[model samples]
Target: MGAEENIGGVAAILRPVAAVIVSVSPSGCVELRLPSRRRSWRCDGVGSAMWIALRQHDGRIGEASEMLAGIWRLDPVDVRCVMNSWAAELCDAGFLRLEK
Candidate 1:
Protein backbone atom coordinates (compact mmCIF):
# COMPACT_ATOMS: atom_id res chain seq x y z
CA MET A 1 0.00 0.00 0.00
CA GLY A 2 1.12 3.57 -0.68
CA ALA A 3 1.55 6.26 1.96
CA GLU A 4 -1.98 7.43 1.34
CA GLU A 5 -3.32 3.88 1.53
CA ASN A 6 -1.31 3.36 4.67
CA ILE A 7 -2.84 6.56 6.03
CA GLY A 8 -6.36 5.64 4.88
CA GLY A 9 -6.65 7.67 1.67
CA VAL A 10 -6.46 10.89 3.66
CA ALA A 11 -3.19 12.29 2.35
CA ALA A 12 -3.98 10.69 -1.00
CA ILE A 13 -6.23 13.62 -1.74
CA LEU A 14 -3.18 15.88 -1.62
CA ARG A 15 -0.71 13.88 -3.73
CA PRO A 16 -1.65 15.64 -6.93
CA VAL A 17 -1.23 19.12 -5.51
CA ALA A 18 1.35 18.79 -2.74
CA ALA A 19 4.92 19.70 -3.66
CA VAL A 20 6.67 17.87 -0.84
CA ILE A 21 5.40 15.47 1.81
CA VAL A 22 5.48 17.39 5.04
CA SER A 23 5.81 15.61 8.34
CA VAL A 24 2.75 13.68 9.50
CA SER A 25 2.01 13.60 13.21
CA PRO A 26 -0.58 12.30 15.68
CA SER A 27 -2.39 15.65 15.82
CA GLY A 28 -3.13 15.75 12.08
CA CYS A 29 -1.69 16.11 8.56
CA VAL A 30 -0.34 19.25 6.87
CA GLU A 31 -1.57 19.19 3.29
CA LEU A 32 -2.99 21.50 0.67
CA ARG A 33 -6.70 21.19 -0.20
CA LEU A 34 -7.51 21.52 -3.94
CA PRO A 35 -11.25 21.44 -4.16
CA SER A 36 -13.24 24.12 -6.00
CA ARG A 37 -13.96 25.91 -2.78
CA ARG A 38 -12.21 28.79 -1.00
CA ARG A 39 -11.97 26.79 2.23
CA SER A 40 -8.87 24.58 2.28
CA TRP A 41 -7.13 22.41 4.92
CA ARG A 42 -4.24 22.73 7.39
CA CYS A 43 -1.90 20.47 9.29
CA ASP A 44 -1.13 20.40 13.01
CA GLY A 45 1.92 18.18 12.61
CA VAL A 46 4.52 17.75 15.33
CA GLY A 47 7.93 19.34 15.92
CA SER A 48 8.97 23.01 15.98
CA ALA A 49 8.21 22.92 12.25
CA MET A 50 4.54 23.52 12.91
CA TRP A 51 5.18 26.03 15.67
CA ILE A 52 6.72 28.35 13.08
CA ALA A 53 4.68 26.87 10.24
CA LEU A 54 1.22 27.73 9.12
CA ARG A 55 -1.27 24.95 9.81
CA GLN A 56 -3.02 25.23 6.46
CA HIS A 57 -2.85 23.78 2.93
CA ASP A 58 -4.14 24.90 -0.42
CA GLY A 59 -4.61 23.46 -3.96
CA ARG A 60 -3.20 26.36 -5.88
CA ILE A 61 -0.06 25.07 -7.53
CA GLY A 62 1.28 28.58 -7.66
CA GLU A 63 1.87 28.65 -3.91
CA ALA A 64 3.58 25.28 -3.56
CA SER A 65 7.05 26.83 -3.48
CA GLU A 66 6.24 29.22 -0.64
CA MET A 67 4.57 26.51 1.41
CA LEU A 68 7.68 24.39 1.10
CA ALA A 69 9.87 27.11 2.56
CA GLY A 70 7.65 27.75 5.60
CA ILE A 71 7.77 23.98 6.28
CA TRP A 72 9.86 24.47 9.39
CA ARG A 73 13.05 23.59 7.59
CA LEU A 74 16.25 25.59 7.14
CA ASP A 75 16.45 24.73 3.48
CA PRO A 76 16.35 27.33 0.71
CA VAL A 77 13.53 29.71 1.55
CA ASP A 78 13.51 31.26 -1.95
CA VAL A 79 10.95 28.94 -3.46
CA ARG A 80 8.92 28.99 -0.28
CA CYS A 81 9.11 32.73 -0.24
CA VAL A 82 7.83 32.98 -3.79
CA MET A 83 5.15 30.40 -3.03
CA ASN A 84 3.86 32.61 -0.24
CA SER A 85 3.24 35.27 -2.84
CA TRP A 86 0.07 33.35 -3.53
CA ALA A 87 -1.00 32.50 -0.03
CA ALA A 88 -4.48 33.49 -0.99
CA GLU A 89 -4.73 30.55 -3.36
CA LEU A 90 -3.09 28.11 -0.95
CA CYS A 91 -5.15 25.83 1.26
CA ASP A 92 -3.91 24.25 4.45
CA ALA A 93 -6.02 21.07 4.70
CA GLY A 94 -5.95 19.43 8.10
CA PHE A 95 -6.73 15.70 8.42
CA LEU A 96 -6.96 13.37 11.39
CA ARG A 97 -5.41 9.95 10.99
CA LEU A 98 -8.01 7.21 10.96
CA GLU A 99 -7.96 5.11 14.10
CA LYS A 100 -6.84 1.62 13.43
Candidate 2:
Protein backbone atom coordinates (compact mmCIF):
# COMPACT_ATOMS: atom_id res chain seq x y z
CA MET A 1 0.00 0.00 0.00
CA GLY A 2 1.02 3.59 -0.47
CA ALA A 3 2.40 5.35 2.60
CA GLU A 4 -0.70 7.47 3.00
CA GLU A 5 -2.91 4.43 2.58
CA ASN A 6 -0.82 2.70 5.18
CA ILE A 7 -1.94 5.27 7.66
CA GLY A 8 -5.34 5.83 6.08
CA GLY A 9 -7.50 5.88 9.16
CA VAL A 10 -7.71 5.90 12.94
CA ALA A 11 -7.50 2.13 12.84
CA ALA A 12 -3.99 2.20 11.47
CA ILE A 13 -1.37 1.01 13.90
CA LEU A 14 1.88 2.93 14.35
CA ARG A 15 4.94 1.84 16.18
CA PRO A 16 8.17 3.71 16.78
CA VAL A 17 11.38 2.04 15.73
CA ALA A 18 14.01 1.23 18.29
CA ALA A 19 16.60 2.99 16.20
CA VAL A 20 15.01 6.39 16.76
CA ILE A 21 15.57 8.11 20.05
CA VAL A 22 12.84 10.55 21.17
CA SER A 23 13.59 13.06 23.85
CA VAL A 24 11.28 15.54 25.54
CA SER A 25 12.71 18.60 27.19
CA PRO A 26 11.42 20.17 30.39
CA SER A 27 10.07 22.98 28.29
CA GLY A 28 7.92 20.42 26.38
CA CYS A 29 9.97 20.43 23.23
CA VAL A 30 10.68 17.18 21.43
CA GLU A 31 13.77 15.90 19.69
CA LEU A 32 14.22 12.74 17.71
CA ARG A 33 17.45 11.27 16.44
CA LEU A 34 18.18 8.38 14.17
CA PRO A 35 21.59 7.34 15.38
CA SER A 36 22.44 5.20 12.40
CA ARG A 37 21.52 7.97 10.00
CA ARG A 38 23.08 10.67 12.17
CA ARG A 39 19.98 12.77 11.61
CA SER A 40 17.57 14.42 14.02
CA TRP A 41 14.23 16.23 14.16
CA ARG A 42 13.27 18.87 16.64
CA CYS A 43 9.62 19.60 17.52
CA ASP A 44 8.18 22.35 19.59
CA GLY A 45 4.62 23.24 20.69
CA VAL A 46 2.00 20.81 19.35
CA GLY A 47 4.56 18.62 17.69
CA SER A 48 6.29 17.94 20.98
CA ALA A 49 3.01 16.97 22.62
CA MET A 50 2.35 14.53 19.81
CA TRP A 51 5.82 13.03 20.14
CA ILE A 52 5.56 12.52 23.87
CA ALA A 53 2.07 11.01 23.57
CA LEU A 54 3.30 8.57 20.97
CA ARG A 55 6.14 7.47 23.23
CA GLN A 56 3.97 7.19 26.33
CA HIS A 57 1.35 5.11 24.57
CA ASP A 58 3.78 2.74 22.86
CA GLY A 59 3.12 4.31 19.49
CA ARG A 60 -0.54 3.51 19.23
CA ILE A 61 -1.63 6.27 16.88
CA GLY A 62 -5.29 6.73 17.84
CA GLU A 63 -4.76 6.55 21.55
CA ALA A 64 -1.86 8.92 21.44
CA SER A 65 -3.84 11.56 19.59
CA GLU A 66 -6.84 11.23 21.88
CA MET A 67 -4.70 11.64 24.97
CA LEU A 68 -2.95 14.62 23.49
CA ALA A 69 -6.19 16.27 22.43
CA GLY A 70 -7.61 16.09 25.93
CA ILE A 71 -4.37 17.21 27.50
CA TRP A 72 -3.95 20.15 25.17
CA ARG A 73 -7.68 20.98 24.98
CA LEU A 74 -7.54 20.81 21.21
CA ASP A 75 -9.96 19.63 18.63
CA PRO A 76 -9.55 15.96 17.72
CA VAL A 77 -9.53 16.89 14.08
CA ASP A 78 -6.48 19.08 14.53
CA VAL A 79 -4.77 16.44 16.62
CA ARG A 80 -5.29 13.81 13.94
CA CYS A 81 -3.98 16.12 11.28
CA VAL A 82 -0.81 16.70 13.23
CA MET A 83 -0.44 13.02 13.94
CA ASN A 84 -0.94 12.09 10.29
CA SER A 85 1.55 14.67 9.07
CA TRP A 86 4.14 13.77 11.66
CA ALA A 87 3.58 10.08 11.08
CA ALA A 88 4.14 10.55 7.40
CA GLU A 89 7.41 12.31 8.00
CA LEU A 90 8.59 9.80 10.57
CA CYS A 91 7.66 6.91 8.33
CA ASP A 92 9.43 8.45 5.37
CA ALA A 93 12.52 8.93 7.51
CA GLY A 94 12.32 5.26 8.68
CA PHE A 95 11.82 6.24 12.28
CA LEU A 96 8.28 4.79 12.45
CA ARG A 97 6.33 1.92 10.96
CA LEU A 98 2.73 1.04 10.15
CA GLU A 99 1.62 -2.45 11.10
CA LYS A 100 -1.17 -4.09 9.27
Candidate 3:
Protein backbone atom coordinates (compact mmCIF):
# COMPACT_ATOMS: atom_id res chain seq x y z
CA MET A 1 0.00 0.00 0.00
CA GLY A 2 1.16 3.54 -0.66
CA ALA A 3 1.42 6.22 1.99
CA GLU A 4 -2.05 7.44 1.18
CA GLU A 5 -3.55 4.03 1.80
CA ASN A 6 -1.32 3.37 4.80
CA ILE A 7 -2.07 6.56 6.65
CA GLY A 8 -5.59 8.04 6.15
CA GLY A 9 -4.54 9.00 2.65
CA VAL A 10 -7.01 10.58 0.29
CA ALA A 11 -6.91 7.32 -1.61
CA ALA A 12 -7.99 5.39 1.44
CA ILE A 13 -11.52 4.10 1.58
CA LEU A 14 -13.30 5.24 4.76
CA ARG A 15 -16.60 4.02 6.06
CA PRO A 16 -18.67 4.48 9.16
CA VAL A 17 -18.16 1.53 11.45
CA ALA A 18 -17.96 0.60 15.13
CA ALA A 19 -21.63 1.13 15.81
CA VAL A 20 -21.43 4.63 14.53
CA ILE A 21 -24.47 6.06 12.83
CA VAL A 22 -24.60 9.01 10.46
CA SER A 23 -27.55 11.29 9.89
CA VAL A 24 -28.11 14.23 7.65
CA SER A 25 -30.54 17.01 8.33
CA PRO A 26 -32.85 18.50 5.80
CA SER A 27 -30.68 21.58 5.91
CA GLY A 28 -27.67 19.52 4.86
CA CYS A 29 -25.90 19.31 8.20
CA VAL A 30 -24.32 16.03 9.17
CA GLU A 31 -24.39 14.32 12.54
CA LEU A 32 -22.61 11.25 13.86
CA ARG A 33 -23.72 9.05 16.67
CA LEU A 34 -21.65 6.65 18.74
CA PRO A 35 -24.17 4.59 20.62
CA SER A 36 -21.59 2.66 22.58
CA ARG A 37 -20.01 5.82 23.85
CA ARG A 38 -23.34 7.60 24.16
CA ARG A 39 -21.85 10.48 22.30
CA SER A 40 -22.74 12.47 19.22
CA TRP A 41 -20.87 14.71 16.81
CA ARG A 42 -22.16 17.40 14.52
CA CYS A 43 -20.10 18.10 11.46
CA ASP A 44 -19.52 21.53 10.09
CA GLY A 45 -20.31 22.48 6.50
CA VAL A 46 -17.16 21.00 5.01
CA GLY A 47 -17.46 17.80 6.99
CA SER A 48 -21.07 17.44 5.98
CA ALA A 49 -20.09 17.68 2.38
CA MET A 50 -17.33 15.13 2.78
CA TRP A 51 -19.53 12.69 4.63
CA ILE A 52 -22.22 12.82 1.99
CA ALA A 53 -19.70 12.38 -0.78
CA LEU A 54 -18.01 9.44 0.91
CA ARG A 55 -21.30 7.68 1.41
CA GLN A 56 -22.34 8.21 -2.17
CA HIS A 57 -19.03 6.88 -3.53
CA ASP A 58 -18.59 3.74 -1.46
CA GLY A 59 -16.09 5.35 0.91
CA ARG A 60 -13.51 6.33 -1.69
CA ILE A 61 -11.80 9.28 -0.02
CA GLY A 62 -9.89 10.76 -2.93
CA GLU A 63 -12.79 10.52 -5.28
CA ALA A 64 -15.11 11.96 -2.71
CA SER A 65 -12.85 14.90 -2.07
CA GLU A 66 -12.51 15.64 -5.75
CA MET A 67 -16.25 15.58 -6.22
CA LEU A 68 -16.76 17.77 -3.18
CA ALA A 69 -14.19 20.26 -4.40
CA GLY A 70 -16.03 20.64 -7.64
CA ILE A 71 -19.40 20.85 -6.01
CA TRP A 72 -18.33 23.23 -3.26
CA ARG A 73 -15.96 25.27 -5.43
CA LEU A 74 -13.15 24.82 -2.93
CA ASP A 75 -9.46 24.21 -3.41
CA PRO A 76 -8.41 20.59 -3.81
CA VAL A 77 -5.49 20.96 -1.40
CA ASP A 78 -7.74 22.24 1.35
CA VAL A 79 -10.23 19.49 0.74
CA ARG A 80 -7.51 16.85 0.92
CA CYS A 81 -6.22 18.21 4.20
CA VAL A 82 -9.68 18.09 5.71
CA MET A 83 -10.22 14.59 4.38
CA ASN A 84 -6.93 13.40 5.87
CA SER A 85 -7.67 14.89 9.25
CA TRP A 86 -11.23 13.60 9.29
CA ALA A 87 -10.14 10.11 8.28
CA ALA A 88 -7.44 10.04 10.93
CA GLU A 89 -9.90 11.14 13.58
CA LEU A 90 -12.41 8.49 12.59
CA CYS A 91 -9.74 5.82 12.54
CA ASP A 92 -8.58 6.84 15.99
CA ALA A 93 -12.14 6.89 17.25
CA GLY A 94 -12.67 3.39 15.86
CA PHE A 95 -15.43 4.67 13.63
CA LEU A 96 -13.59 3.91 10.41
CA ARG A 97 -11.50 0.96 9.25
CA LEU A 98 -9.27 0.59 6.23
CA GLU A 99 -9.74 -2.29 3.87
CA LYS A 100 -6.74 -4.55 3.62
Candidate 4:
Protein backbone atom coordinates (compact mmCIF):
# COMPACT_ATOMS: atom_id res chain seq x y z
CA MET A 1 0.00 0.00 0.00
CA GLY A 2 0.99 3.56 -0.61
CA ALA A 3 1.99 5.91 2.18
CA GLU A 4 -1.41 7.56 2.15
CA GLU A 5 -3.19 4.26 2.19
CA ASN A 6 -1.04 3.17 5.07
CA ILE A 7 -1.26 6.34 7.11
CA GLY A 8 -4.39 8.26 6.21
CA GLY A 9 -6.60 6.64 8.75
CA VAL A 10 -7.86 7.73 12.17
CA ALA A 11 -6.40 4.66 13.86
CA ALA A 12 -2.88 5.34 12.64
CA ILE A 13 -0.32 6.53 15.15
CA LEU A 14 2.02 9.19 13.85
CA ARG A 15 5.33 10.19 15.28
CA PRO A 16 8.24 12.23 14.11
CA VAL A 17 11.54 10.50 13.70
CA ALA A 18 14.11 10.64 16.45
CA ALA A 19 16.16 13.28 14.72
CA VAL A 20 13.30 15.63 14.02
CA ILE A 21 13.59 19.08 15.51
CA VAL A 22 10.34 20.82 16.28
CA SER A 23 10.13 24.53 16.90
CA VAL A 24 7.05 26.40 17.87
CA SER A 25 6.79 30.16 17.68
CA PRO A 26 4.85 32.35 20.04
CA SER A 27 2.38 32.93 17.25
CA GLY A 28 1.55 29.24 17.07
CA CYS A 29 3.59 28.61 13.96
CA VAL A 30 5.33 25.25 13.97
CA GLU A 31 8.51 24.35 12.20
CA LEU A 32 9.62 20.77 11.72
CA ARG A 33 13.08 19.81 10.63
CA LEU A 34 14.87 16.62 9.78
CA PRO A 35 18.57 17.38 9.95
CA SER A 36 19.57 14.14 8.28
CA ARG A 37 17.46 14.88 5.23
CA ARG A 38 17.97 18.64 5.28
CA ARG A 39 14.22 18.94 5.09
CA SER A 40 11.90 21.35 6.85
CA TRP A 41 8.23 22.18 6.91
CA ARG A 42 6.37 25.15 8.29
CA CYS A 43 2.89 24.89 9.68
CA ASP A 44 0.84 27.95 10.56
CA GLY A 45 -2.54 28.63 12.09
CA VAL A 46 -4.77 25.59 11.92
CA GLY A 47 -1.96 23.35 10.85
CA SER A 48 0.01 24.45 13.82
CA ALA A 49 -2.91 23.72 16.08
CA MET A 50 -3.28 20.25 14.63
CA TRP A 51 0.36 19.46 15.14
CA ILE A 52 0.20 20.60 18.72
CA ALA A 53 -2.94 18.62 19.28
CA LEU A 54 -1.41 15.46 17.91
CA ARG A 55 1.57 15.82 20.16
CA GLN A 56 -0.53 16.63 23.20
CA HIS A 57 -2.77 13.70 22.48
CA ASP A 58 0.14 11.34 22.16
CA GLY A 59 -0.08 10.84 18.43
CA ARG A 60 -3.66 9.72 18.50
CA ILE A 61 -5.08 10.81 15.18
CA GLY A 62 -8.69 10.44 16.23
CA GLU A 63 -8.24 12.54 19.33
CA ALA A 64 -6.33 15.18 17.47
CA SER A 65 -8.97 15.40 14.77
CA GLU A 66 -11.77 15.55 17.28
CA MET A 67 -10.07 18.33 19.19
CA LEU A 68 -9.51 20.33 16.06
CA ALA A 69 -13.03 19.73 14.85
CA GLY A 70 -14.44 21.05 18.10
CA ILE A 71 -12.25 24.12 17.98
CA TRP A 72 -13.03 24.85 14.33
CA ARG A 73 -16.72 23.95 14.57
CA LEU A 74 -16.23 21.45 11.75
CA ASP A 75 -17.26 17.87 11.29
CA PRO A 76 -14.92 15.44 12.98
CA VAL A 77 -14.82 13.32 9.87
CA ASP A 78 -13.66 16.26 7.74
CA VAL A 79 -10.97 17.13 10.24
CA ARG A 80 -9.87 13.52 10.29
CA CYS A 81 -9.53 13.55 6.52
CA VAL A 82 -7.38 16.65 6.61
CA MET A 83 -5.28 15.41 9.48
CA ASN A 84 -4.79 12.04 7.82
CA SER A 85 -3.80 13.64 4.55
CA TRP A 86 -1.32 15.89 6.23
CA ALA A 87 0.14 13.05 8.23
CA ALA A 88 0.39 10.90 5.13
CA GLU A 89 2.22 13.63 3.27
CA LEU A 90 4.68 14.02 6.12
CA CYS A 91 5.13 10.28 6.29
CA ASP A 92 5.82 10.13 2.56
CA ALA A 93 8.37 12.90 2.97
CA GLY A 94 10.19 10.82 5.60
CA PHE A 95 9.51 13.21 8.43
CA LEU A 96 7.08 10.96 10.25
CA ARG A 97 6.60 7.26 10.90
CA LEU A 98 3.45 5.23 11.31
CA GLU A 99 3.15 2.93 14.29
CA LYS A 100 0.95 -0.14 14.29
Best by lDDT: 4
Error of 3 at 73 (Å): 2.5
What does candidate 3's lDDT look like per residue over 1-100, in tens digits? 2326655544556778859888887887998888888878788887787778888989877788788888879997778778878877777776777764
Candidate scoring better on TM-score of 3 and 4:
4
Model 4 stretches with alpha carbons more than 4 Å out: 1-11
lDDT of 3 at 63: 80
Q: TM-score per candidate, in order?
A: 0.21, 0.74, 0.78, 0.84
Question: lDDT (CA) for every model shown?
Answer: 0.36, 0.76, 0.77, 0.81
Evaluated against the true structure, the overall lDDT of model 3 is 0.77
- Model 3 scores a TM of 0.78
lDDT, residue 22, model 4: 94
Tens-digit lDDT track of model 2 for 1-100: 2323344463456777778887877887888889899988888787777777887887676678888889879997688777888888888888788776
In terms of TM-score, the best-performing candidate is 4
What would the per-residue lDDT of candidate 4 be over residues 14-40, giving only the tens digit for each residue?
888889999987877999999888999
Q: Provide C-alpha RMSD values for all models, in order.
A: 13.7, 3.4, 3.3, 3.4
**Candidate 3 residue 29 C-alpha distance from true site, Å:** 1.7
Writing each residue's lDDT as its tens digit, candidate 1 over 2-47 gives: 3122344343222233333334345556544434444444534432
Give the 10-residue window scoring lowest on summed lDDT in candidate 1.
91-100
